[model samples]
Target: MTIAYDWLALGAAACWAVTGLISAPQSRHLGAFAFTRWRMGLVFLALAPVAWLSGGLQQLSLVQLGILVLSGLVGIFIGDTALFASMNRLGPRRTGVLFATHAFFSAVLGFLFLDERMGAQALVGGVLIVAGVMTAIAWGARKDESHAFESLQGHWPTGVALGLLAALCQAGGSFIAKPVMAAGVDPMAAMVVRVGVTCLAHLLLLWSGVGLARAQGTMTPRVLGLVLLSGAIGMGLGMSLILLALRHGEVGMVGILSSVSPVLVLPLLWLTMGRAPARGAWWGAAMTVGGTVLVLLRSHS
Candidate 1:
């Protein structure tokens, strides 16, 4: 049933929420590029066996494999690194809200490239989603907020720019993979290709002797554990769900559902940080969800 992909999309959202909660400290500890590289390596190691055992690698043509590699480069490598960089500067909650713009990007890209129709209702939903993201970023922080998770790192504008870049890359990567997924590629196999290529790319970057690409902190056993867990849930489970959903669902609808990570992360942040989100956070999350629902309704109609 179509509802099945909806559940998959929601599941991916939940997974990403948990991932963000776990990843904040790790991102801070390792720096964005290093953290993403480590995370991708762990995910690739864990998934390679499963994909090989399932014979999913045999399902792809060279062209499909090439697309998956590009997806990994854009989505996992660049998008993920930008995401964690934004997270390091802006914290998880704010980054999540900004990253929610990917839903709007996905919808528009779907219309332009996938022959997906965007009616008036969907257009309105897209506007609301963008407005909600801007509203949340502008007022999401409280003056009295003293938690590490709420503190700003580097430049706020830079963080915002990185978050938007991550969103665009996320949508672009998914759009690139949609056709391949629709062609009956195995989700696990596709993940292996994507993650493997990404992991290799990270290795090459690290080996290139770029100071910015090097690890910012010493790797501890605790940090390693956190990275592994984050990668397992975030990339291993979360991304596989996206691929599966893409196999059967439209890009816009799947992106809208998965973008609920911003809402889900609020409670997780509250639980971890021992305080509720700022008032603007709740309002922005509400508008985003409302927009998502509107879009879904239009899709069904």
Candidate 2:
């Protein structure tokens, strides 16, 4: 991968990490679903003007529009919703650990659906990444060794399931977006279409699942501002960076870097929480991160 793409991928990860902090307060008050729904809407509202100004709005064909819109729905709407549910259940740190599994998930999905080929290094890296995840979250059995079985006992099945859904959603979105972005539409129009679909999907979700929360009241200005900030960070900024990285380098490289989110999350958590994981979880996190790094290195050369 080129240095520019490396920076872009890393930058995307940082913005996404910061977004977790931004969205936390809003999720606390508005609830995750309610917060995500509004965040999705406001993001498009904020992105639309910029997209228009960039003249990204004027360059769309019907087919590109459809694919782009679908990309948004799959990625932000479904992915974000499932992710929040998983995060709530698993906590950001552990959920992040699961999310680090994204490289593997994408690989699997592509293998099954797209017939993508994985060379030896890529395959090894995939194994290491999964092992790293297992390590990062692993606990112990009677021998007090890191036990996969113990890690499996954590309150994260639903989180893992939802995370898997989010991973697939994001992968699907990225897959669809390739042609759209490559088709050379207005970048802003692309943004608008992407977030617009997210907005609509969130609306449907709110109507169906967040009725009680929605009826509580619209968000306060501060809440809305923060949610919008997160949406900008996540969708506007984070995803944008990913697209840029793809333009500059290999998707496999970017995907591997993305799996490093768990490692990034740990320091963020350590700073935020003022504590480290217990020995087992700590070791698990280390191994998981190391494994991910191994995977990245395997492909990088």
Candidate 3:
């Protein structure tokens, strides 16, 4: 079961990596906020039918619905806001490095709230995983761009604070959803509720003239296709896999595995961009894999 969770988490990571590729240009064309709004709306539309068809929606109690909604608000809404803010302040490379702290935050919060304990091997593995991710983000950026170091010129303290808060909120949101998933709620049903809440929240923001109140450009076929692809991979499939992982494995471990998106994205980028990944990127991938093996091995032992 735990192994299944690990694989599911990896699948989720792959989905997110695909989303990044599809959405980056699309978001550039449509503006970030507007793209996100459309993406969330698409995810809701995609998941709602699945939930209904699978009878997952009918099995949820009111309490479970509430948990999922809250999780969505915190994880999707608030967490995303903080993440973007941090990115604005620190830029992508620094922000990516900071965002990797989410796994550590998830683990520590799980221990504090759920009393989940890890063995020494798991601890070492977790640290290595984080270190590898950070190294990859920081070093890969240096190799990939001449202007990468320029992104570090912002208010470091504020960015760091918001980044950490985002991490905590993300982990907390996942932790809150675990008990309901453990209680036999279908991951798809939970996903419907979660995505529904985020969609509603985004709509409210738009309605109130708070954020992404209008479309950035006329929706073209290319933009529409990219949006659909990104939403399907990142939110529809990626989020469902995450919920399934949380159902079958500890949230902390799942978080760590899912955080491997940076490592996973390397080959895809190389293939698409017609460039080999930096040596640092390869090292990062190797370390991430080694660490994951250690964590899984120790957990089962």
Q: TM per model?
A: 0.92, 0.79, 0.88
Each candidate: RMSD: 2.1, 5.0, 2.9
State the C-alpha lDDT per candidate.
0.86, 0.65, 0.76
Candidate 2: pairs in clash = 56-186, 56-189, 132-288, 135-284, 136-284, 136-285
Could you tell me the lDDT of residue 297 within candidate 1?
Answer: 64
- For 164-257, candidate 2 gives per-residue lDDT tens digits of 8877776676666765665555556777788787777767766676563362345788887888888888778888887766554445556656
Better of 2 and 3 by TM-score: 3
Instruction: Write model 1 residue lDDT over 1-301, tens digit each, in one string.
Output: 6667877988999999999989999999889989998998988888899888888998689999999999989988999999999999999878987898898889888878788865788678756756665566556667898889888999999999999999999998999999999998999999999999988988898899888789999999999999999999999999999999999888987887788787777777778777777898778777877776676566455
Q: Model 3, 145-234: lDDT tens per residue?
A: 544222444578988887787777778888989898878788878888887887787788788886445665777987988898888888
How many clashing pairs per prediction, in order?
Answer: 0, 6, 0
**Model 2: runs farther than 4 Å from truth?**
1-3, 112-115, 138-157, 184-187, 204-218, 248-252, 279-301
List the candidate numbers ranked by lDDT, top first: 1, 3, 2
Model 2 quality (TM-score): 0.79
